[model samples]
Target: MLSSLALALSCLLIISPNTSAAPNSVPAAGQSIPLIRRAQPERTVAEWESWAKNEREALTAKYGGNIEKRSTGTNLMTNQNADSSYFGTVAIGTPPISFNVILDTGSSDLWVADQACTTGCSKVQLFNDLSSSTFHNLSEPFSIQYGSGAAVGTLGQDVVQMAGFSVPNQIFGAVTQASSGLLNPPVSGLLGLGWQSIASSKASPFWQTLASSGLWTDPVMAFQLTRFVNATNVNTEEPGGSFTMGFLNSSLYTGTIDYQALPTTPSYWILPMKSLTVQGNSITIPSGSSSYSAIDTGTTLVGGPSSIIQSIFAQIPGSQPGTGSWQGYWTYPCGTAVNVAISFGGPSWPISPADFQLTKLTSSQCVGAFFELNTGGSAPNWIIGDTFLKNVYSVFRFTPAAVGFAALSNTAVAMNGVNAPAPSPTIGSVSASATAGTGGGSNAASHRWSVSCASLVGGIVVAVGAAWM
Candidate 1:
């Protein structure tokens, strides 16, 4: 649960003197930025799924079991108007400015938007340090806090520029003051990739200042989000995927990539979950360190533990629990062939039941991005978002930092917007008896649902219009 929310590879590469190569030591091969998903005309897709279920009910009431909690001193959370979901495009000092951030692996700083902020950061583009000549005023001073607001600011350094590569100095955060969920943020701040011991600008965490300044030939980082699964302008913004830093693009992913090793406690990408089967039931969760498991690309859904998500729909057929602003939401009947699976030590993966349906709350019904996070008692922390990470092709390595997952890369299954198909690692060991709803008509015998964890826990605010990518 980092509060700020949130490469390099190959092709003739070799540079390890503990990094920082570029003074002519060669290296260079790493760059590619497109990552688009913009749409946020003042928030929709059910207001970004009701602000990601109100930031997972304010991180289960502010760190209850406190899983992976790291703070180094300052903390930030800024989910202001959120909605850009996944963004890209860097460029910083010496006249660069460009911006458009938000690529969080769930927290580590790299802020922006500081021409002395002025107020609610006026929708994007700022950072002017008196028109830059490689700005560097590290006058130190900071503060970040968000689930909806706060930014303050100080610290600085320059030269970042992406795609065309270049690192130069790169320390970040400039803000001046912000909040209002980052006033106009659909991207213009946030580029963390996590771990620098939970950085709040303690500095050296912009991909470890781009691999100690050598700028990347392979410290590895990869992602291929896409999935707008169009139900018409699924929010709009466009582009969708691509953001490789060091190198992994073996055409986006398929077969062998797996990687995992993260929990030496660096912060956020933490893993080791090992099991979660549904439809073949294996639910019994809630374990140590708040139940480890984090993988959050800026979280958009998929949570856990409310008694193993109410014993995973009490084990699926016509699932339920949803009413009056859909309290704790959950619904079914669209094509209910539910399967769900998760494991992190390898094999078990599976997901796709039309990616767990999440929307259609009428005209034949549907809803369910899997939320239930009552970690309030702690030791049950789980987040894994992008509704199962857009079906996979992830990879986030920093030397041996680790976090990988593959399959989904025939250009991300042809930019899924319902092109569907491609994400079948299949897994079903035991729970499968609740399937019906094959082609609509007869409204599948009028779909009525219910599954109370005491009527879906609390902070109820359901809304899954779709494409909260």
Candidate 2:
């Protein structure tokens, strides 16, 4: 799922109801639902590092190379810009009709915004499959192409929901020509969680059809994501971060997760890494092969291989290079102390230079979430994102397709002890200033500010996408 806890973090829809969850059925497999993730509006760290260097150069120019080179059904994962991107609220078809979508594990299918969209669409909520009655259309004809925009649309089915979790019919996509960076506000469509193969309608997303329709006994999917510290950092009135589905919440983590093994051939949750340090040393990247990485909670910043991020920003210190819309970016200088780590084979995980420092741009420059990416030649992947996964505690599973990690939920024992402090500087006063504004829509008041985005899905409509294998 994703982590890296502090940088305006916000999204906690924790639903731990083991029983008592009927009303529309489905919610038995270790029940867990949470939705309220925000962190890309509250800018100041130099305007959220210039909108994360234009969303990492529009996701390395639309999904840097070998992005699972799709063709089976149609490819997807196109974006125009949704700064930091993350949204919730599902409900689709039948008597239901809610819509807020955009969860993405880096490309799949699911869709929304139909009513024959209107130029650059985004007036929000739409998808009237003839006013639903368990809609089912299937005229097929979907499309997706992003680097800045695109979405065709046709497919159908319906009755999907979330939280209380239902899953009748399913399928998804309705749009009808979109591309205004997907309406660019809160989020209007998306929820792929990768690996149904790359779904272009190859199907099987929507929680793998509720984990094979058994209603999720465990197909696995977990994420944490909460790292706010500015605009009045509100730690937790309750749900701070969660997306668990089908189980594995050992009380939200703390040590012994590690796990690994996963490489079903470019299907996303990739692994292998084994390098990239800075204050603790290491920084190789001569690459000839074996240097993978892809965790990607639908990426936001961390991409890689522009010469291994210019050799880890030439070992940070005054770090520079960026220019004009953050040229290739690497800009650091704001409160430099830097530690940064990332091994993923055994030891070293660290990463908390306040999650790779970014934002703050004049009082002495700032910006460094490491983004260079152009890996087209393959091998040098990376991606990572969520500023090093909000500080660990991921999962992903799927019957041993693996990808785990631990250490969050109160520093997982001071990060396994060895002098952990670090992580500090959750961005405080680079003179504070302000002047970013433009937050428009979605965040719906922090989803009940303090927790409870209320989800038990009585109004089903689960579209889901990502089909390849």
Candidate 3:
């Protein structure tokens, strides 16, 4: 989901953070960091649907609706929790205070709870600027809204180290107050990997700063997002996979990488998607439908236009639109293998059926991974998330402004096993019916895009909160 906050807050006032110092040392290219996958306990189908609703609402607020034209904008799965986010540990300040933060490619901004955050920072580790001799306060305010909650703070600069690489004078928000929903224990903040143009803070993201400082050998970052829903053993937390900077790891993928050129003046990793197919049948996108798609690593499920999503489920037997709280969603037979794929001016990459079945709903019905989205205007119509990303090795290249995808290697595929024949109660289930539409399309209409600006500073703000959406 591209945060509407990016677009709505583009004209935010800016106070440049000092970037005078060089890194302690230039690390070699291809530095890899292991990602931690945190899974919440399994919830009922209704609970999962509710979570999905919130996720979509947050996205709607971020991208949908009539965004204020003041200025700029920009821009998981489960469990076995039905909602999992990937994290990588990064240290801020002089002596290096480490915090496990989400590696989000959706928006551009890096932030963590400040020592002064008394509102919802009690449980998580806070960044104590007083202890770090190198910390500098930019004296600029910052605030960002998320679907679950919002965080408010001030801009600050310090040394940031991750995976053996150190970037000095990195500007980030030191949150003073936040909603409890944005605070997931042990998961302190987020590291934005999107373009600087869409950054609410109007500051270079950590990765871009590292590249500009001549520390990166190739100016590329790649991800191998692992899965666990179909694993033989389920756990609350597990190894999500790898995040490599400066170079791509050949061992994680096979064959030539299919690189899709991004739009000029790109914000998110927006690209042209030629078509979408379900069970090898191409689904027709309406005439006014958006042709551009955003390869968002920060989102959980795949979201498309409402009518297009409805067309997708129509091809599956026994498929039905969600009724009450599950509106804007579709469900099908749990045992049905729904093969889906999408092309980006190259060979169509197939999505595993296991990932398509988000979670089981009943003895016979299972929720599909695709959801409906209506962004009102010409934003990217398709928002691709982990449901399709986990099947490939994704690389975000800066120079050419392109996103590359390659087939996952056997070793990478073995991390998550195939989906079981039927639903497992221990996995998760909810109460729902595959009947005629009741609260279906109407619920989606209710979400017809809106923006919620939680807080702002110096005319600039960026989301450094949770990446659960």
Off by over 4 Å in 1: 1-75, 80-103, 106-122, 135-168, 171-205, 210-259, 262-276, 279-296, 299-315, 319-341, 346-366, 370-397, 404-469
Which digits, one per residue and each the tens of the lDDT, describe model 2 over residues 106-171?
665677878887765656667888888888787767766533346776778777766556556667
lDDT of 1 by residue, 1-469 (tens): 4334221233224334344543435444552222345785787788899899678868976877433221111011122121225566566777676676666776666777787787777767777888889787867676654333456677777776555455556677788777544534445677677766556655556565555444455667777776563245444355456666666778767789888888765666778687788888787665556558668676556766666676788778788877665555578777677789887878778777765666676777687778665433322267676667778888778768889898785766776554222221111121111111111111111010111222222332221111121
Better of 2 and 3 by TM-score: 3
For all predictions, the C-alpha RMSD in Å is 27.2, 27.3, 24.0
Best by TM-score: 3
TM-score, every prediction: 0.29, 0.30, 0.71
Q: Candidate 3, 457: how far from true, in Å?
A: 32
lDDT ranking, high to low: 3, 1, 2
- lDDT, model 2, position 278: 84
Which scores better on lDDT, 1 or 3?
3
> Which digits, one per residue and each the tens of the lDDT, describe model 3 over residues 1-469?
5488774444232322432224554423333222334898989999999899778767878886542211100001122233356666777887887786777787677889988887877777899999999998888777765544666788887877766566567778888887755656666777878877666567777777655444555667888877876665555556676777667778889998899888657687887778789998998764322677778776667777788899999899899987665666788999899999988888889999988987777788998878776544445677777788888999898887799999999887775644432121111111111111111010101111122222321121122222443
The 10 consecutive residues of candidate 1 with the worst lDDT sum are 440-449
